[model samples]
Target chain A: MLTIDSLTKRYGRGAPAVDDVSFTCAPGTITGFLGPNGAGKSTTLRMLTGLTPPTSGSATVLGLRYPDLPNPGRVVGVMLDASAQHAGRTGRETLRLAASLVGVPAARADDMLERVGLAGAERRRVRGYSLGMRQRLGIATALLGDPLALVLDEPANGLDPEGIRWMRELLREFAAGGGTVLLSSHLLHEVEATVDRLVVIGAGRVVAQGALADLLAGSGVVVRATEPDRLAAALRAAGVTAAPTGDGALRVDADAETVGRAALAAGAVLTELRAADGGRLEDLFFSLTGAAGSGAPARTEVAA
Target chain B: MTATTVATTGDGTSRALPEVPRIPFSRIVSVELRKSLDTRAGTLLVAAAVLLTLAPVGWQLTHLTDGVPDFDLWVSSARGGVALFLPVIGILAMTSEWTQRTALTTFTLVSRRGRVLAAKLAAAVLVGVAVMAFVLAVAAAALLVASGLEGTTPVWGDVGSVVGGSLVASALNVTMGAAFGAAIAQSAAAITMFLVAPTLWQVVGTALLGDDAQWLDVFQAFARLSSFELAGHDAQVVTSVLAWVGLPLAFGWVRALRRNVS
Candidate 1:
């Protein structure tokens, strides 16, 4: 388990980069750390890995601070930057060196290279490798010690679709084996597809966090009828929050059954009625953070 | 940090994952030594140093009309040429991490940043020793050739100072280069400062203190140290080392230990 308690990092008197943030990544779960660019995701990862000191609070891996952990590489694997590799060494040599540092046998280097699909390119210098290849090598380096927990920042940025699928499955298998994973990304769809839990941060603070299913099971319904505004007003009279989704649809904070009863009692003919999508994590993300383009769920738009 | 606690399976049998040992410092040093010579740039710099050492001896041989050069003279000349180029190899060892952006990977694996720096230093000192030995062998061969042409016995007098002085000079030069490399993490900036700072300081000191007080100049003081002549100016040599090597090394060590890898 990884516990981050009220962690904060401030750069020279400027506002905090990561401010009073706290969360836990339980074992056997893939937690997606979602945020926009400069959202303190990398800074937090850096602090956790002991690459940068935290201004206040602490981040511990397996109940111990990163630097204090014995053989930390075997306990917590981190890949903050995939391209942060020595360009002079061959791909195979890089893995071998990492294996040596982590106290793993040299044979693991060849095994990891083939596993990451870099077997043929093992003799090539890293300077000659493409971005996607470098990402694969970075993954290989992180897994060199078979760590119990992994922390990666934007590991899928340079991967192709097939590579991304492979990575998704790899992390899934890792978590299945009781390993903890905290993957940070700005790519909403990829995180949505891979994570069992979500921690959405914005402007250095967490705006929302919970299990994927629990967070997505929204208590709302989408209603469409002959007169949208009239139906919306009737739902408001019934102590239900109703707003237009800008696609000729009304999103009401009431179950579909209650919404149907409200429309019927108000004598409003309904053309369409359905439960609000519990999978609109993106919309929920933007709404919670007040990000640009979130524009309160009041505008009419096509329902997904 | 492992536990002996066992987990029960579905059939109530207990199993545990085997524990692995942590890596030793010797392994870190070996990896660093390998890395020092693994780079294309490092290999080329070493080859260039060797060729440069040979070029001077070749010139000395062709120009040997004055009763053949002394064996000591040949050794000193060869050491001079190798010394000029070997510092770059040492500087590359320290600055390569920042230039190639590998500090992240290196530090993440090791975690204790000081250990990595220590390994790099050890690697550089070994390179200096190896290069000094190679230069000594080639210089000795040239000395033998010159003595044979003149039909005179090879003079072994002063051989101890010649060998000892040259090794010390080469080691100091490489260490200074590493200090500069650490102080200025960028390769270009470190090399520029390493080559130009002492000369600029000498010029300023000469202008201020006049001809008689050249000993006050850092470059001159270092020359005295490299010469291995212990009869005079011991104080000046100490001061020069503090100014040139100690100060910059302190700056670099603090930065390396404190700076964020990103």
Candidate 2:
């Protein structure tokens, strides 16, 4: 299992790259950590795996910090970047070297190479391999220790449809065997199909997080009223979260029926009341992350 | 705790789990050595060092009448070849992790970066020793052939001093190169800085302070080191070594430990 407790990373007194981000991924499931480019997904993963130290808070695997773990490679397989593989060594040599470091039999490396369908290409140098091939090799290296948990960053990038499907199946099989997988990706639909849980971030803060279905299914209602202020106040009084999604619409954290009842009670004329999720999870993803945008969030909103 | 020990689970509860073995220093050293040998660049460096070592022997064989065909001449020639290539090889070994973006994988596998660095240094020193051994073997063979020729004065000048000093001097060169590599991180920049910056300093220093500044010259000290005759240059050797090798090494160690592998 993996847990991130209010982890924050601020470089050189600038705004925190990852601001108070927290989430947990359980065994037997895949948690998709999603964000746009520069949304600090990689930074968060780096901190989680102990590459970059967090400014505050903690990220741990199996209730132990990565560095504190007796042998992290034996417990947590980490692939922060596919492109980070050495370009010099042949694919076979790469696996063999990692195997020796991991104290596993060299045969395991060959097995992994064959498992990743890189058997024929094992003799080729990594410099000649494509980006997708690097990802495969990286995955093979991560699995070399036969770890209980896997942390992959943008593992699906540069993969063909078949390769992605293979990876999805691989992750699925891993999770099915009581393995915990925390993967970060900006590929919405790809993750939407694979992940059991979602942790979406924008501007270094968690915009939304929950089980995949719960986050996408009627998360809240988008209500447009003649007096949005009155409706928002009523929703707030009812302990329902409400935020202006622009265009005179309030994104209310309640079902349509509950929202309708609250609006009627508030005596606010409702011209529009619909589920906030216009389509599938993409709409919710866009709505939640789009509002925060990228880079630094509005300071006034952060202060609030 | 035994190999089978209790570990805390993610749910804030303790459970029994098998303790896997730590990545041993020996394995890491082997890996570092392999990292230095497996690449094309690594192979070429060693091959070039060998060729350069042998090239002088061939030339000396043809131009035998010019000088006494002695062990000193052949040993010194091989030492030059090994010393010249040793630093380049060492720099590549240290900086390739950053240049190839492999530090992420390396550090992730073995979280304690100090161990990796220690392995790199150990591996580099071992490579230096091994290369020096090869150089000596070739030098001895060349000396034997040259001494066999008529009118050639057979001279093994201070075998202990030359062999011992050459080993120490070559190791220092490689280690210094690694320190520069570690401090700068980028391969090209680190190599350029290491190869050029000190020479420029020596030139300017000599121009300004005359021969008095030779005390601060690392290159001179290392050259004199091969003779193992520091009658009056002991302090100079120590001072130059401290200024050139020690400072950069300490700074590089800290940087290696603290810098985030991106």
**Tens-digit lDDT track for model 1 on A44-77?**
9999988899999999875667876657778777
lDDT of 2 by residue, B1-262 (tens): 1233445555543334347777779989999999899888888888988998888888887787766556867888877766777887667767888889889998988888889888998898889878988898889888877767755657887888877877887788888888888878778898899889889979999999998887789988887776677779889988888888888877888888888778
Clashing pairs in 1: A245-A299, A245-A300, A245-A301, A246-A299, A246-A300, A246-A301, A247-A300, A247-A301
lDDT of 2 by residue, A29-69 (tens): 89999877778899999999888889999998767888877
- Listed per model in order, the count of residue pairs whose N, CA or C atoms clash below 3 Å is 8, 0
Instruction: Tell me the DockQ of each model, to 2 decimals.
Output: 0.42, 0.42
Lowest summed lDDT across 10 adjacent residues in model 1 chain A is found at: A295-304
Give the CAPRI rating of model 2.
acceptable
TM-scores for all predictions:
0.89, 0.86
Q: For model 1, what is the error of residue A190's alpha carbon versus the real structure, in angstroms, after optimal superposition? A: 1.7
Full-model lDDT for every candidate: 0.80, 0.83
